[model samples]
Structure formats: C-alpha cells, structure tokens
Target: MDGHHHTAHSVFPKVSTTGKKGKDQKSAKSAKKPRKAEVNYLPPYPTGENEESQEQERIQLLTEAPTNPNSNLTRDVVIRCLIVYLEESLDHVLKRYDDADEDSVSQDLTVQRMKIYSIKTNTSDCPDDVGIVVEGMKVLAALGNFPRACSMLLGLTYAVNVANPKELRYTFEVFQKFLLELDCSKLSPKVNSLKNKTASLGKWALAK
Candidate 1:
C-alpha cells in the first residue's frame, strides 16, 4: 500500500535526463525495472519467507511471537496484514481446490481448514507478530481488537477444529478470572474467586 506509486515507477523507470546513458538507451532498456528492495512492513505488516513443513508451523511463530512493545506499530501492522491474510487465505484455498473434479464436493473446498501465512518472499527484519489470517477471526485479530478477535476465535474453534493461539492466550480469554483456551485442561484455582468478582462488577454496574 505504502509502495504503490513506487512500484509503478519501477515498472516504468524515468528517462535519465543526465546524458547519452539516457539518449543511447533503447525503449526496452528504458522500460526495464530494477530489482526490488526487501520490505519489512515494520509500521504494521511483514513476511520474510516460507518453508513451513506443517499447517501449524505456518502460524505458530506469528501468534506466539512477542507482541511488539510498540503496540502502535503492532496495531498498524496487525490491521494491515489482517486484510492480507484474509484475502490470501482465500486465494490459497481456491488454488488448492482448483481441480475440476472438486466441483461435485464443494464442502472440501471450504476455507475453514486453511492455515494462514504470508506468501511474501521479499522481506527483512520483520516484527514477529506479523501474519495473514485465521479468517474472520484472523481479520479481527489483525484489526487490533482483541476482544472481538477472541469472540471470533472461540466461535471458529467451536465451529471447526480451529486451533487456539498458544502464545497469545490472554488476548482471547473469556474473563480474567477464568480462560477458556482449549489447550488448558484445568480451570484456574482462583476461578471461583474471579467469577465472584466479575459477578460483583456486573451487579454493581446495574445497581438500582
């Protein structure tokens, strides 16, 4: 996004007005583009490469990567890449199910089973938290709205066998008193206390 005009300019490099280096060049040579610099998408997006061997690996690092201490930049990248992953995940699913025979079995083409990842090859010192998607849930996380993100996450999990984010567990907890992460089997010892406290807040909020 930030590089749109720059990309266009590269495709059609400006005529060098300095000397014969510009004049002697043929039209094809003038139109030839230079190599692109690696993009880090630091302000809110990123992808360095992809050699993932498992579906889980595609998103493992992105979810568990430390949330940037700079939430501002993290927020921005999260919002931007969220869209990328949503669109890209669909793109991946479509490509995977491109066979003509699958038309008879549309359910197999559904994207709920798709794993998310940046298809980006050009990259540099990328922030760890950057990635593309868990779909609707993916986009919500990308939008920097973790509460909504959590809601979609839980709903998606219950719908399909969507995996819970292992590293960023707090982002999707139902309440501070008790989390509903599927990976965690036992309820917190303090859950009852937390439930009471949350109930108290609600009761006080509705005081008559």
Candidate 2:
C-alpha cells in the first residue's frame, strides 16, 4: 500500500497553482513594456529634382481637369496650384541659368510671374496679395537682377489691385526695403522712376 501511494504521488507531482500564477504575471508584465512610437514626416524643403517632379504632377493635374462642366475647380485651389508652379518655375530658372546673364535668367521668371498675375486677373474675386511677388523681387534684387526686379515690381503693382490699406502698406514697405538694398548704379532710369513713384509708401508694420 505504501509503495502504491508513493507511485501515485510521484505520478501526480505537486504543482503549485501559485507558481503558475506568478509565471503568468511575470509574462504579462514583460509584455507591457513601452516602445518608442514611430512617426513619418514630410520634408520641409524639397530638393531640385523633387521640385521638378512635383511641378510636373501639378501641371498634369491641371490638364486632367474634370470633363464635367459642373466640376468644382475652386479659385483658391487653382491659385494654390499656380503658386506651387511659380515656385517650381523659379527653382528651374535658378538651376538652368546658373551662369547666364540676369536678363536671360529673368526671362522664364517674368513669364511665370505674368502667368500668375493673368490668372489672378481672371479671378477678380480672389484678391492678389503682393507678398509672393515682393518675395520674388527681393530674391532678384539680391541676385543683382535690379532692372528685372524693378520691372517686375512695377508690373506687379499695376496688375495686383491692393484695395486693402493694410495689404498695400505692407507691400510697399517690403518693396521699399528691397529698393534700399539695391545697387543704385545698376538700376536704370526707369527703375529709379519706379522707386520714386512708390517713395511715399512706407512705414513697415511690426512682424507678426
């Protein structure tokens, strides 16, 4: 009987439920360790090649306009797309004519700016802000493209009707700042006249 009892006890080894519970608890705790979260982000500034590709994509989107006459191609959407195209065109101009004269370099830029203004003119409801145009002028002036800068500034001023006093003042301030930084000797008589015309417009607003 003793031998049978020993055999039975041995066959059914005493396993503590507490031990099993502890093991499970350990596994659960281990499984709950925090991991670093992964995130994907877009680049702030695209490379030259990326700019070209993106511009082409935007053009393709323009061409593939919905056939339906009732399609919603909003002015804001078109303007945004055109702005992107202008940026891309500027990049292209900079890249392509790295060694060209200012006149030659400004050709493409002039065309693009005119095109943007033309679109803005057509969409009278969408008021043109001179911010982007001012920025382009600043860049051209910095690059010693003074004549082109002057021409662009004058043309843009005429094209964009800044009825908003705040916007007009701000645009003139930016333009005047650009003029101040220009090499006076490089500026033509026409440029000087243009500068004189806008002389009364100044008093920069505090930056937001």
Best by lDDT: 1
lDDT of 2 by residue, 171-192 (tens): 3333333333311334445445
Q: Which residue pairs in candidate 1 collide?
A: 44-77, 85-132
TM-score of each model, in listed order:
0.25, 0.17
- Scored against the true structure, residue 131 in model 2 reaches a CA lDDT of 20
- Model 1 scores a C-alpha lDDT of 0.36
lDDT (tens digit, per residue) of candidate 1 on 26-133: 654675443323221122112332223222442442454355436544654653454353232223321221223434323432344433322212343332232224
> Candidates' lDDT values, in order?
0.36, 0.34
Query: Please, what's the RMSD in Å of model 2?
Result: 28.3
User: For candidate 2, which ten residues in a row score worst on lDDT?
Assistant: 36-45
What number of clashing residue pairs does each candidate have, in the order they appear? 2, 0
Candidate 2 — which residues are off by over 4 angstroms?
1-49, 66-208
